[model samples]
Target: MEFLQILDSDIRPGGLIEWIPAAPGGLGAWHRDPRGTSHNHEQHLRSAHDYRRATRREGGREAWLGLAVEFDQQIDFPAVQGALLAWINRHEVLRTHVRLDGPDVARYTTDPGTVLLRRSRIGWYHDPRLLIEQIAGSFDRATTPMHWPAYRFATVARAGSFTLFFAADHSLVDGYSLVNAQYELRELYQAARERRPAALPPTGSYVDFSSSERTAADAADDRHPAVAVWREFLGGADRLPPFGILPAPPTGAGPPPAQHSHTTLLLDDDATRALTDRATALGGSLIGALLAVAALVYHRHGGCRFTTLMPRHTRHHVEFHGALGWFVALAPISVDVSDDPDFALALERTMVSLDRAREGASLPMLRLAELIGIPPEPKFVVSFMDTRGVPGAVEADAGAAVALRSHTYADDEVYVWFNRTPGGLRLHSRFPAGGDGPGEAGLAAFLNEFAHLLASIAAGG
Candidate 1:
């Protein structure tokens, strides 16, 4: 409760909120409330994915979320390290350990003193690209226990510049949390440099969030309104329609291996602005418009209706606004473009479905899967993250600098990510390289067509 009081002061008018450790046996003993806290719905889904990957022939790749920030001038290495440590001490999620041995595998925020800082330095480098790749490579190889600390931090230094990289498990942080962590790191570093206390407020632990989610899920009846909505959306289908243009082979001719490849589509400033304006005029989000375009593409390719997973941020709680951890979940959105011949009509239908999906956004995919008895694996995924006003990309101070980037390890059949940038928008589509789904060439062509469709829709054609 005292910790809650500290968090309450964080948003007070004027000045930064300074954390004061509670009296002995107060905040320190909070973790002892219950051993092995229950796993939240998101954790269950993530763990399932992890398990499947582990069982594969090559095993699952490490799910690493990476961030890189470049500085215009030299940085104080020790100060940055201190800032990272300070951040770990302030946020419980950073200190939490994943417990995998017991009957119930849960996450717990343990003592701050016991939390260790994993830091390494990459010696001098002339090329920023090399430095970035080296940092990313290091992250790609790094691994952590599902029940252990979930993050690592490193810095690459040159004569007059430096880049900071933080890599953590996908279960540890989501896209939003990754950006939030960078912002907090910047502030904490500045506070450390000035020898002034950081103004960061107390944050709720991921454990607290898990407990709350468990309670809410239990209290809700099985026949809740959301359950019915999910039932209708699923419509007794066991598996989503395949996304590949080519029919999959019945059996493997050789080894059951998998590969992944991706392509990016960039929209110029004018096109991006027009697309945003058109979406606004249609009273929908950029995501809705994009979904409409995707549906149309699939419809034209001979599939009239199919289900796609859409990522939704689940940090609706006030305490979680800036909390670090994975707070993202996927919801299935069924697209039926059969009835609507006109693109405009199709867009309207897509918007309406999207609106309804948002109403039940809080419902977890794992729960929906159970209730609807649909296949657990997602065939196609669509995600959108708006980074219009984040602090990492821009130069915060004269000599100080920051940048953030993220990568996923899961090799889904098809995954499309949309990121909003200062220049315009960047669409990255990834799919298995040689799997039954569309091959690399087919995916590239699909992306090209999708872009053209998006442009035409934006032009109100």
Candidate 2:
């Protein structure tokens, strides 16, 4: 049995390595945090708790894997499980976690989560009635994170048999990882059931890549492009912008469900083609166009300019770029939403800024915080990514698949995020539930208007 090795992201080279044993019941998992020190760990947990507790003002609030196949032909559990494991093995990050203490301590995964191969009719019960109830139950009972750990997976019985699900802490994995895992699991399961050889790829270990990345970051004399982008865009703008998106709730109030619901906008082949063509014409990429609209929405909401933090994987150029460990650099960039008429040109500028931040990604988050004079806990953070890995490319499956989806917590003060999928582009905004911030309806309406404005831009309206 392979064991999952957990590591602390914040630990410098030659740090201490602490090993925690996994619990029984075939629920094999562990928590790998970015902060290795006791102080940072406590602070991170507190931040997560606060995020969950503050959801009532704007709306309601707070916030898996497995394999098994139907005995029948339709749902292939074995295949899916096999594929997922293969993918995990293929991606170095999934296989490794930060070791708390060690010389050059990095991601190591001797322990992989338990993989159960079982038969069930749970998946085949596509009856709308049963399906909806089961899904609802899963949603209701699923544990929302009170803290940020590595990743997690769970499954439950609905109606006749059982259904498997994956619940991972977002801080550890992103949307692309989940999708790839799913694909790998499916492939692995099918091959096993059929008694055929599984064709798994050769992926590097997360530890190797992470340590290498730190080395590269430290060695690079240049600042990450994203940070540079932020510095240039801010151009003397306030590092700490005013908090106007939502207000905090009064003390001693019970937590409420967050009002911010996520929605994905798929740009079909035609739409993707049209948007990309126009974007190129306007001197921007698809991401540039999306940023323009997002800026517009932010401007309309508060007339304030703020930084949008994006995660860039540093696994690149390392031996284990595809590995599953947290080797990402978060660069928070501010776009001057208050200026410029041509949204395209504005997006181009933002893109340029992103480049700078990436270049200087070797600077640790804590170091950046110190340099910027911002605490770990800031106002809501808005992130944007072009998710081309999952459900990306209309040509992949004839374009009928749902490409883009997002999960965000209003538990913290943060409100919105923007992303791109195969279908189109989506703007995911999370508003406060209680009195902590804005509600989903208001945020949605705001996005709707902004979308229309972008449409006009696309149509030259």
Candidate 3:
């Protein structure tokens, strides 16, 4: 309450209070072992903050948010900057910092905070070919655990035009938030540039939602039905089998070069509608269609039974939707399709398995990691996430604005990642470049071929 007046703003009846009370530092706070997961997490946070500070000094505001905006018409940068500052001053979350005590963590306020917004504009290019290279090279590596308040924005130019890029810490926001923010900012930029009033929407802040969700999640007691569902689904299978044969040791084999590749498969609006129509005709949902197709792909590539992991958002469960942080329960779905199997039946089984998994969704990812003895590094992790876009998830922020973007890291720890895109129900497999050690080109080709195979099945060909 005392800090509320620090920014020269009137206090409101309902607002998030910066009440950390000098608790433990979040960086050092560990729910599990202090040396293993916690240690690595701590190091990552410190290094990330330090790197961001350095980039800020060099690139200015844009470096902080990793944002670069280009204007077709002339606009005043300083005015825009001023407006942003005022907006920040009024928002308490922007000026807040986290304090780390050994075992407990708390949020607090800090003067002259390290986080700052920077801007730059570029015009004209000396060497046309080098322009894109320079701009592309300028972007900072993406961060994880998205947090919105920590985001920064910057602008730069090399050719006769300019663009804006936003760089922000990953802890505060998620992909859904980034999309909403972009739309809002575009409206704001247009209004300011055109000297017209901006039309912004009213929405709740993530911080507020997160706080409430945590309380509710902690209070839930009914676990019978959910647990039973999982028990039935898992049956007597104690563990999931590795998809492929473990390559022989070096001298002759050292695990046939890891088959790693990532690509996105999308179903546009029309395509999605058609897919849905087809599903209804077959008595299934769009998700069922996608899963059946994915199962088919796995069968072809692995030549054996495989399990895919899907996160249970618990949207249907009154206890979970709209919760902040991951309420995801990993449900390993097994699909064994013969050379030619019933697509509709395959879909029905997949859907039923997932539903049961969600019902018993208390198992966390880390728990699974420990149970499987998944070494520090893993060959691949096949995962699927389904969350509503910003439009449906959170009300639009009218006071400032919101955008949603995501930065993820799998490294060698994870080989294959399967995700769902916003466009339609199509699944996307994202992989890091240089995933295959040598003969990268050959590995890339294999990935392409595999995707083509999947796409073919999706078309019901």
Candidate 4:
């Protein structure tokens, strides 16, 4: 095949190579050499969180983001390998290595051509789940400030089909960046197969964004409006609310186990459509409605107002749309269900609170913790990703079917992940099993109530 022939000279299986530079005076030239760059505020926050987690015995395992994409038909392995190299060459974030120069500072260095593309093959009978788990488990085995690459890629073959698995450090890419990279990889593969150059356009690098973020943070004063907003949100509270739905543990019980349990909730198509319509009529988003339902459920179960760490995509600039990097930040949204028992009113209030949060959405979570003198970790966190609207489905010329699979590791006391699938909205909740939080039975009951509340709100009750 032409693709195979093209890859013969470019693909280096389980070896390091000097990445070939694309045409000069284009996007390819933007990061042709390794250079030191300062870490952005968000990057600093992630680094600090990772460092803190490292202090625990089982802490560092959750730092990796794992993805697996399967194709129904056989794929050109070498061509795909070449595409991976090309994709890495285009994004400096993939080539970046983080090192702590001081107690509080992390410096990023980009090694342009030294990326090691490790490759391996799995048998047809190999279990996919075990492979994914193995990759995720070893993510933090090695210490940082080392020369290892930020990511690992592998190809697996199973009876005329193939699966591409990727695992990377959380500091390098977020959910949005992972999706963007998959899309770009598909395009690059197609172009490579056709013996034509990839049509990737120029975009700003993470280095540039980091420099700009540092400048903005330095220019802002302690009394800045955003900082004040965060301070007020904390309300002079010494500690954030607990995430458990059950009663609190006794004092001196010791810290909870670091492991988590997962539960999922699914809505049918009709229910999802109804909720979408209701959210539209209420002048809010489905995510907002869900959050409102969560707040109501937590209040009814725990009898108190609570705060959640809500993530916002920080790629507001046009140049960041197609770029791959960790461009996400979390905003703390406090919900008080006692103020309004009415579901509609509660949803409205939730929407308003979320809107206000957008005002300082760009602020780093670590900075907010420092300003308020609160613990950096939030008890409850919510994350949403809508992948149904991606531009195109991954399809190879050989008529192979492609599907993207994403997996997240949780480090919080409670984490809720929402994904918009073709059938409906899917919710996955991960919470500490032996912690002060809800146990298995309590969590199941909470999920049931959340579903019921969501349905009621969508029905305009």
Per-prediction TM-score, please? 0.79, 0.66, 0.59, 0.78
- Put down candidate 2 lDDT per residue, 114-217, tens digits, no spaces: 32233223343434455434433342333233311233333333334333344444334444444344444444656777878765455565455444444544
Local lDDT at 187 for model 2? 49
Question: Which of the two candidates, 1 or 3, achieves a greater lDDT against the reference?
Answer: 1
> Per-residue lDDT of 5-27 in model 1, one digit per residue for the tens?
11111111111111112223333
On TM-score, the candidate that comes out on top is 1
Task: Kindly list the per-residue Cα lDDT of model 4 for residues 1-461, writing each as its tens digit.
Answer: 00110101111122111222232233332333333333333444455456567655433334455444545555776677678877777877766555544554444444456454555433232444555444434444421223235456666554565656555555666666655555577678778778789877776677666666656655666676667667666773313433344335535535444444443436765888789888878887888888888778877765456467788887789898777766776776766776546667777878887887775565666555555564665666788877555444223211222222223233245567776655567676655454354555676677888888787766666
> Residues 2-98, candidate 3, lDDT per residue (tens digit)?
0000112111111111101121343233123121122212233444545456544322122222222334443456545543543343233344433
Please list the residue runs of candidate 1 whose C-alpha ends up more than 4 Å from where it truly belongs after superposition. Answer: 1-60, 101-103, 118-141, 199-203, 236-265, 392-412, 436-438
The local lDDT score (0 to 100) that residue 236 gets in candidate 2 is: 47
Q: What range of 10 consecutive residues in model 1 has the weakest lDDT sum? A: 1-10
What lDDT score belongs to each candidate, Candidate 1 first? 0.58, 0.45, 0.40, 0.57
Q: What is the C-alpha RMSD of each candidate to the true structure, in Å?
A: 8.6, 9.7, 11.6, 7.6
Candidate closest to the true structure, highest lDDT: 1
| Backbone clashes in model 3 | 57
Q: Flag clash pairs in model 1.
A: 68-403, 69-403, 98-147, 259-433
Q: Which ranges in model 4 have alpha carbons more than 4 Å from their true place?
A: 1-60, 103-116, 120-133, 140-147, 199-201, 236-258, 261-265, 393-412, 435-437
